[model samples]
Target: MSSDMNKDWPLYEVFIRSKNGLDHKHVGSLHAADATMAIENARDVYTRRMEGNSIWVVESKYITASDPSAQDPFFDPAEDKIYRHPTFYELPEELTHM
Candidate 1:
């Protein structure tokens, strides 16, 4: 592999705003030399029609995510806790939207 191809750049996560959407959604990730290159690469790969007007590229190293394997310890304690659920609450007839 060439030096450029072999060079290990930081991974970047890309978000794109579709033509009709008001928010940018995470589309994919790629390894890039820097943020600028990542944006260009994301544009080429995600928005072929100039369909997206906004591009956000974040370093993968900075991304923090929840661990699914720890789900039981992380969230299950709240399952039997009925105070967290709203189903038992009664609403007034006049407050239909609420």
Candidate 2:
């Protein structure tokens, strides 16, 4: 297909959740005619090894994301909310993981 025709296909962002994973991780993007095709393509391309237990395909245009460049002001207010941090609990020195 021509580049322009390819661009007309909806862009899909793929996420895969492994059997051992608690959350889906964004694996990659692809172009597909529709959601069903997107999911099928994602499974064939990304989970051919049978590594993922679940898959998600979202059209790129529908996703809302925070701007990385605005991180300072966008997230600064949360920094002042000290209670949100888990620093109040004291762990025993013998516990290495904390």
Give the TM-scores of the predictions, in the order they appear. 0.70, 0.75
lDDT of each: 0.85, 0.92
Candidate 2 per-residue lDDT, tens place, 22-65, comes to 79999999999999999999989999998699999999999999
- Candidate 1 local lDDT, 1-98, one digit each (tens): 46677367878999988766589889889878889999988888888977688999999879999999999999999988988778787888888766
On the 0 to 100 scale, the lDDT of residue 1 in model 2 is 70
- Candidate 1 regions exceeding 4 Å error are 1-7, 19-21, 49-51, 88-98
Model 1's C-alpha root-mean-square deviation from the true structure amounts to 3.6
Model 2 regions lying over 4 Å from their true place: 76-83, 91-98
**Model 2 alpha-carbon miss at residue 28, Å:** 1.1
